[model samples]
Target: MEVKRVRALAQRALIRRWAEDLGSPSAGLATVEAIRSHLSRWVERRHGTFSFRLTQVLTGHGCLGRYLHRIARREMTSSCHECGAPSDTALHTLIEFSAWGPQRHSLAAFVGGDLSLPSVINAMIDSERCWKEMVLFCENVMTQKEAAERERENSTADPLRRRGPGRRRLRYGHLLLPP
Candidate 1:
C-alpha cells in the first residue's frame, strides 16, 4: 500500500511538471492545445507511423508560415506563400489552402466533409489508407512550404541570418553563461 501511494504521488508530480512545461510560452512547441486535445492520454494507441512531416503537421512547428513568423521569426508575415491566407496555420494549410485544394478535397471526400482534427484522427484510426493519405498530404504540403521558405530566405536581404535546424540564433543576452 505504501509503495502504491508513493508511485501515485510520483506520477502526479510528473504530470504536474509536464502541464507546467506545456504551459510555458518558450516551450518551443506551438501546438499545446492540439497536444492536450489529441494526445494527453498515454494508454491510447497511435494510429499512424511516426515521421517528421507528420510531427510538423500535427504540432504546427515546422515550415508553416505562421510558425515560422510567430515562433521562429523566420518569416516577415504569417501569410500562406501560395494563397496569401492571413495566417498559414496547420489547419489552414490542411483544410483551406487553395494551393492544396485537390489534396484537401480528396481528403475531405475520403472523410466525408468532416475535416476537423478529431475527424481526421478518427479516420486515420479507422483505416490504414486514411493514415497513408494523411501522411502523404503532410509530406506534399510541408515539402513545398519548406522549399518556398528556403527560396524566400535566399532571396531576402540577409540570408546569412537564417539558422539551420537544431541551431538557435543567439542574442546578446544569451551569450552569457548562468552563474
Candidate 2:
C-alpha cells in the first residue's frame, strides 16, 4: 500500500543514507539545490529575528564583554565598585550576585515573581518585560548618587532660603486688624 511505501521511505536508516549522500563532497547539483530549498523553507517557517536589547547590551556598548570579564574574575582593568566582585559577564552579574540579589528579586517580582535569569534576559531582549530593571542595574547607581547630592544641596540651602527677603515672615508683635 501507499502508507507502507511512505513509512519505509520515512525510516531513520533511509533518512541517514540520504543525508550522508547529500553531505558527501561529491553531491550532485540536484542534491545541493534540494538542501538549499529545504533550508529556505525552514527559515521562512521559523521567521526568526535578532533581539534588539540583546544586541545592544552584548555589542552596542561593550557591556556584555566587560560584564563577562568581571564575573570570570580574570585580571580586568576595572571591577564593579559597589560589590567589588570581579564582574564576570552580564548574565552572571544579573543572575548570580550576593550584593545584587535583592535588586534581582525585586525585578523578578515585577515580572510575575519568577526569578529565572534566562527568562528575565529573554523578556528584556524581546522588549516585552521590564528591561529598565537591567538598565537600572548598570546606570542607577549614578542616579542614587545624584539624588544624594541634590538632597545635600537642598538641606544646605534651606536656612538661607528661609532668611531671604523673598520669603515673607510675620512677627508676633505685627498683628493688625483687617481694614
Per-prediction TM-score to the true structure, in the order listed: 0.68, 0.32
Native-to-model Cα distance after best TM-score fit, residue 107 in candidate 1, in Å? 1.5
Name the runs in model 1 displaced over 4 angstroms: 1-43, 159-161, 164-179
Q: Please write out the lDDT profile of model 2 over residues 1-179, one tens digit for every residue.
A: 99988876677456566556656544234324434334323233332344444333333223333432443222233344345555434444456656657776777765556545445544454453365665555454324423543554466644421223322335533455666
> Which run of 10 residues does model 2 get worst, by summed lDDT?
160-169
Q: What is the C-alpha lDDT profile of model 1 across 22-120, one tens digit per residue?
A: 776455354564444444342144556867998888778898878888888877788877887899888898878778888888788777688777778
Top lDDT hit = 1
lDDT of all predictions: 0.74, 0.45
| Model 1 C-alpha lDDT versus the unseen true structure | 0.74
